[model samples]
Target: MGYWSSVLLVFLGSCSYGVLSTFVKLAYQAGFLPGEVSGSQMFFAMVFMWGVALLFSRRKVRGKQWLTLAGTGLATGLTGILYYQSLQYVPASIAIVLLFQFTWIGVIIESFIERRRPGVEKVAALVLLATGTLLAGGVLAGEFGSLHPVGILFGLLSAVTYALFIIFSGRVGHEISPYTRSAVMLTGSVLITFIVYPPSFLLNGALTEGLLVYALPLALFGGVIPTLFFTLGVPHVGGGLATILSAAELPMAVFMSSVVLHEKVSLLQWLGVVIILVGIAVPELSHKHRTAAVRDRG
Candidate 1:
């Protein structure tokens, strides 16, 4: 696949994740607890992914590869668990801003792994992304109320785990089929989720009691689409660029909140969304221009 195509996949994957907060909020309003909401989503996602893997994945995964992908899923599962927990204490706006910290965290992780400093384009993009997140998250709009310390902790930890996920999702189990890889990794995620929040939703009939509606969408957007897309795209795009592309999620989340949740998005927030889109484009546009220039010289 072309590099641009891979970048598009990652973009779509991150956007899919951006839609999850709306559905999660809906589930909460419907009276489902956080454990129930997260647990059910992972449960359904694990089952569906394994089904797809059985039908489509042909490559046999080695034991070590299985272990590695499963371990990586720890980050995946914790990201949701922690971020959701954070929302309980802080407003969604604050929680999202906290989660958006993954933008820089991801860049830092890539720098450490690659043993090099970030290029000027990435640094500039991070600045734009940070500025945009503050605006879009309404932090500068005076959205702050009484901020809970525990919520802030969960939100920041979620950023660290999410950054780890972006970095490792591209690095591990390269030879395994994306289908099989997503399944194994999701299995690991489900285990962590279940351990953290027991599977009481199963016996409590939450699935039959309206949680299934929310769970299905959550599983589709949060679990399946992002997992498979990241598995397919992140390796080709590399973690740094993929991290920048993943900023697409924040603007998307803002759009979803306004449209679905009927939240009032101020004009400044819209400006922030525009800035974020530009930030997402910076590295890609820079690379494309450089490539065209090199070709002209040749």
Candidate 2:
């Protein structure tokens, strides 16, 4: 696939994720608790992804890949739990912004694990992303009232776990098919969710109804599809580029909130969003330019 095609795939994946938050919020409004909503989503996603995997996969999953997928799934499930928990205490917009701190978390983790410093472009991108996130989130305007400390901590934890997911999955290499890997991960997530919240599936009331109606779609769009796409596409695009493209989720979420939820984003917030996009784009563009220059020189 060409570079632009890969980018388009990533964009579509991000947009899918962007639309997912609204469904989650709707589920919450319908009275589902965080753990219950999260558990149900994982369970359904596993079932769906497994069916898809069976259709597409030709090779069987090996023991090592199984282990990797298990670990990845556990991390992913816990991240979802933490993210949902944050939503209970904070606005979806704020929780998402905090979760997106993963962009920097990924960079820092990659640098430390590789024992190498980040390039100038990456460092600049990180700074811009950070500053822009704060601005967009209105963190500087003393608007932290909407943010709970516990929720903030969980959000950061989600970012860390997500970064680990990307790092470990990347290190696992590309031998395993995306279909098989997604199936394994989804199964692991299902098991972890069941273990953590056994009563969730057993609960009776409006919550279950909400899960069936609203959260199910959220899980399918936000939980299942994005994971599948990223697992497949990131290897082709590289994590750095994927991360940059995934930043689109932030702006897309804001746009969706405005259009669907009738939420108003301040001018500063929109400007911050623009700045963040520039930050993500600059590094990729520079890298592409340098690669072309090197090719020409050769």
Q: Indicate the worst ten consecutive residues by lDDT in candidate 1.
A: 88-97
Tell me the deviation in Å of residue 214 in model 2: 1.6
Report the CA-based lDDT of candidate 2 relative to the real structure: 0.75
lDDT of 1: 0.90
Candidate 2 lDDT by residue in tens digits, 161-210: 77676556555536877777877887887787778778445556544454
lDDT of 2 at 111: 76
Candidate 2: RMSD to truth: 2.2
- Taken over the whole model, the C-alpha lDDT of each candidate is 0.90, 0.75
Candidate 2: residue pairs that collide: none
